[model samples]
Target: MGDPAAQALCAALRDRDWRAARDVLVTVTDPDDQAFCMYAAGRVPDVQEWIGEWADAEPRSTLPLLVRGTHAVHWAWQARGSASASRTREEQFREFHRRLTFAENLLDEVAGRDADDTTARAFLVTAARGRQVGRDEAHRRFAEVVARHPWHRLAHAQMLQYRCAKWFGSDEEMFDFARTAAAKAPAASGLAHLVASAHLEIWLRLRSGEDNRYLQQAEVRAEVRAAADHSVRHPQHGRYAGWPTPHNMFAMAFAVGGDHAAAAEQFRTIGDQVTELPWAYAGNPVRVFRKWRGKVTDSVA
Candidate 1:
């Protein structure tokens, strides 16, 4: 229903065709692409029921393990629901930790079995967040991912989440991480999304009216534009498989930042594509996407 690979993998899982799913996954070598595939595949319903069988059948291959581990994160979140910790019940918290620990164990096995497995290492960054790993430990896990794949987008994004104000880190830490990564990243890559992500996080953290004010700040607007230049606007930026994410991210950032014209540009590039993230953070995915989309294009609503 989403990415082509995701659809194929989802179909394979529904049909209990692990072999076909493996075939679709094995072709993807890049860390970003692999992570994207995993993200989509992990969201499919009833995966936990059969994913274990795939893991058991392929004792040698880490692909099944990776799939299971990635799905575990989704499973953990589902158990916990989307409510803040204060709102979550004790039972949900316990189950969240239990599932996260399971995910951590599988990811740890993959990384240990193959030291250079950036995909496994990237998912570890995610597991660390739910597990509430120590700051130093989280840094170590993230470092392992970037050491193998310096521009590992999933790893960076996951690490940013762990360091967000809503999580372990504070606002200063979040901006520092985002800006430093964008500065070090090579042009044309989408590292700049980190900056947009940080801004979005901060905006979401504030009170209702304060949230909009934060995004509307002059400095915030300038940085968001600069981030756009570093990514979507860069001439060398080619449309990759997950291209819609960055466009949608920057579109949301600009839309909230009171730059309707810039928002329009990103919205144009995005066209009809709506990624789960960036919008899902605000409200109902499709409704929120179309609201801002209508604001910019006067066509989506």
Candidate 2:
């Protein structure tokens, strides 16, 4: 039977009242629901506590614990300046390893299965492992998954495009690829953002280099504006919202088009709302721009 407390918590969350959700979730007797609720409420400390309680009560339920534990670890890392953060980080890492071992055992139990569940599990494992190791390897594994199941092609393509954007030097080639990918996967807002980002990057590069291609600048700005507008209207499903990429892109386009005051206002808006770790973008354009902004400004000056 479903826990009544959990049901209440779900109802509260649906109403967007996190405080009520947290209170109800903490009262729930079910470990799974407790862990999920704590995560939804962004209550990292409570999540860690629930993970420990759940792990001891049911050792086999490791995957959910691990997912919650990862969130705890991420939060703990952000709390690095706190006195207890180091110990919390170490504890979370140990739990992560335990969860990984359990996941491996679970996979072994269903080895050779051709079921969709197995494929999904494999895909998640690959993506998680990729984050832990190298982006290139992660993209390679994602590509394999898509090849086996074309239904996942759009997601894999977005990941690959992110990898290319972060590590590759050839802007024209990357932009071409992004344009094609975006056209092929019209439903994927992430790919659409990448397409817009590629154009923005080209514009940034040209402006820094004093390339007087004003016609090209106008075209790139229009393309980026359209993509950003589209992404704002149709964000990718299951992706984190409120990213400042589109805002930053619009600001950049305005700045390049001699709208300094508008650009400054946009930048201020982004700077005000940009949290330290709101979401993870493997090949985030805003991060890249921030890292190189000083150098670009100096060169242009």
Candidate 3:
């Protein structure tokens, strides 16, 4: 029931067909896979609700439980008001803490029943961050997951965030994890995308004017190029699960680095699917992606 529509959605997403994207996303079944597609399309609420329905229907399925935790963290992040909001910041923090606590409990419940639920363990990293848990605990959760699924893309991405300096990890630690993860993954497994993800995190943290220079740095550009060659651009790159998400990250990195040609190729690979993250740091990801795509298309034309 879900496969044909999900496949069609994947094909349309590969072509960047935005118009029919939503209609197709409704057909997907796998909780994380469906959430990935929905997130790319900016349908966060829909995915959360759909996952909730799945959880209700199949309370035994740990997949929906894990996705629910991710969704809660997303909401909790939103609840944490910005620095400018002094009036409601306290209230926002309360809501944020509540959400994070809920997500952590959900993950803990998942862990209790299924010790092998790596996805739940991976998501625990995010919930822990939101809850202001210590980095050591977050790392422990991440290690528990990666030890099981060494090449788990979602787990690696979550771990990358936990390893970020903003979350108590230093630059050296973040990059080391990125490089190590890439080195350990099988070729064409799309694990190398973590390098580009690390660079994007660094670029986002840099001062406004420093972003361009930071991206163009010898090592930064080298890492990005290596990740591209090893993953999306590899001649034998396979269409692994959640393929377009990494392409979106790579595309954004190249576009920001002034490498329109490389960005265009990644855009071509990702088509219309656009996620909230990495792009959200720059502002409305949909608009940013459209602007970059236009620039890439003009450069090619």
Alpha carbon lDDT of each predicted model: 0.86, 0.45, 0.71
Minimal lDDT window, size 10, model 3: 37-46
Q: Can you list the residue pairs that collide in candidate 2?
A: none
Q: Candidate 1's residue-wise lDDT over 67-159, tens digit each?
A: 888888888989999887789999999999999999889889888898778887888898888888899999999999988989988888888
Backbone clashes in each candidate structure, one number apiece? 0, 0, 2
Clashing pairs in 1: none
Best by TM-score: 1
Ranking by TM-score: 1, 3, 2
CA deviation > 4 Å runs, candidate 3: 1-70, 81-88
Compared with the true structure, the alpha-carbon lDDT of candidate 3 equals: 0.71
lDDT of 2 at 289: 45
Per-residue lDDT value at 241 in model 2: 29
Candidates sorted by lDDT, best first: 1, 3, 2
After TM-score superposition, the amount by which residue 106's alpha carbon in candidate 3 deviates from its true location, in angstroms, is 2.0
- Top-lDDT structure, candidate number: 1
TM-score of each: 0.95, 0.43, 0.77
Model 3 over residues 161-241: C-alpha lDDT tens digits?
877888778889999998997887765678788898889888888899898688877777777988888888888776645
